[model samples]
Target: MKRITVSLLLFLFLVTCSQSDIRHNQDLEDTTYSIVEDKNESVIRLSSLTTFDWEKAFLFSPYSPQEMIEEQLDVDFKDPSDLDMRDDIYLLVFLNKGKVVQYAEIERQDADFSIEGNLTPSNDGINIERY
Candidate 1:
């Protein structure tokens, strides 16, 4: 009986933990933002940024030129089926010399404001996308 109870408890714990999807976006305060990709061309320098909380890019950024960074992040959410289901993702990105370029949320169902602090700041030219 003791062993059976213990197994049941362990199984319940794992099942509960794995089903979470960061829905209703109460995890914004626990966000993990990172600065990714910076580069210098003889003609122009470029940089990018993105955010991640518990799931989804919130802001999925790909390395692009400094000028085109904003243009690129026009995230193509083909089917935002879960838009109203729960947590909306938010992301902020900047370019060279602390240039604020993009700051927006995706699929969030709450009115949570972004937490402005450096979870990770760029030193040289780094491109980070959360895993």
Candidate 2:
């Protein structure tokens, strides 16, 4: 019985851990896939602008951004239950209105995606002050 219990626990641990690796090809994910906006418009898509595959490399690292989600805050933090635990966070870096800014790797299908994640000159980035 003890062996069975230990085996079950170990299996559960491994199962929980493996999900972090799924869909986590960080090179392909991090490498920028340029989306041309137009000439003189000077807009670019930041969805795939990372050169580092922080997701896979940092999945188990203590410094991972997902660590930021587990803590409680006065401000609204996206419920991880609502988000794909497998979803990796990336920086959406681009230039807009002559200022460079970084956005959270947000997908339209993400439950966490909302008007709040949007970066705008008017926001002055006060919204993203937290981790």
lDDT of 2 at 33: 23
* Per-prediction CA RMSD (Å): 15.2, 14.0
How many backbone clashes can be found in candidate 2?
Answer: 0
Q: Give the alpha-carbon lDDT of every model.
A: 0.31, 0.31
Tens digits of lDDT, candidate 2, 67-125: 35333122222333333344534333223333222223433121121123343333322
The candidate 2 region of ten consecutive residues with least summed lDDT is 54-63
List model 1 lDDT by residue over 80-117, tens digit each: 22222334443333322232222333322222323222
